[model samples]
Target: EDQVTQSPEALRLQEGESSSLNCSYTVSGLRGLFWYRQDPGKGPEFLFTLYSAGEEKEKERLKATLTKKESFLHITAPKPEDSATYLCAVQAVRVQGAQKLVFGQGTRLTINP
Candidate 1:
């Protein structure tokens, strides 16, 4: 079965501290890997879409990279506003001409001043 696992479930950091969140996945016929950031009581906001290995994307203080088996969300100099739950999802090709997303539990990051 295809699944995604995120490590360190939660992280608490002082403002300006940098960290990396891990998203490991295994799937058949991978179509794309997705990254999202979710705030409390709100839907996830799309961050990146990785179509192949060796692909990387960046937005402000956040950078996402993908390899064959896993993806990483690297946060640099995060501020209190950066606190959120980071989610990883995978889209795999299906036999029925459809695609489904498998999501990781998410890593909750708290940045305090």
Candidate 2:
């Protein structure tokens, strides 16, 4: 069985406020973890890929870190334009060719000036 859930359906933040996004998951076997950012009506843009528990990736004002049971996406000094839906996509190579991706509900973030 594999499942993923994200918290704080939405978030409001000051332009520079820092916060962390959480994704909790359960799976039969670990394959890979993925993070993506999506605006209102566009396809997701890949952010990071975590292959193991102790791995991490970062870019600009965002950072993604992963563990065995969960992953966190941290935002630092965000700006108004950073407001968007953050999505977490996962995949299990163990499943072979059954499904290519699994997606979370997404966390909507708003940065206020």
Candidate 3:
């Protein structure tokens, strides 16, 4: 079965603290891995797309990396504004090539100033 699971359901960090969130997945054929930041009561905002192992992408304080079975979102020196639910989603290769995202339960991060 293809699925994604994220660890440490919630994290609380002081401003300027750093942490890493884990997204573990099991997929038949991984087409792509995606990361998003979602605020409460709002939709997700795209952060990065990772294809193939060892691929990494970054935006400001957030860095995303991919592996065969899992992906990681590393938060470096996060500020209060960087606090949000980090989402991990995966797209699987399909026969018709129509890709759909399977999203994991996001990790809620709070950066306290």
- CA RMSD per model (angstroms): 0.9, 1.2, 0.9
* Residues 24-67, model 2: lDDT tens digits: 88876767888999999898999898989989898999999999
- What candidate 3 gets wrong by more than 4 Å, as runs, is none
Which ten-residue region of model 2 has the weakest summed lDDT? 92-101
Where in model 2 is the C-alpha error above 4 Å? Answer: none
Clashing pairs in 2: none
Query: Which candidate order results from sorting by TM-score in descending order?
Result: 3, 1, 2
TM-score-superior candidate, 2 or 3: 3
Q: Considering lDDT, which of the candidate structures 1 and 3 is the better prediction for this target?
A: 1
TM-score for each predicted model, relative to the true structure: 0.96, 0.94, 0.96
- Evaluated against the true structure, the overall lDDT of model 3 is 0.92
| lDDT by residue for model 3 (21-83), tens | 999999989989999889989999999999899999988888999989889999999899988
lDDT per model vs. reference = 0.94, 0.89, 0.92
> What is candidate 2's CA lDDT for residue 2?
72
Worst 10 residues of 1 by lDDT: 93-102
**Residue 38, model 3, lDDT:** 98
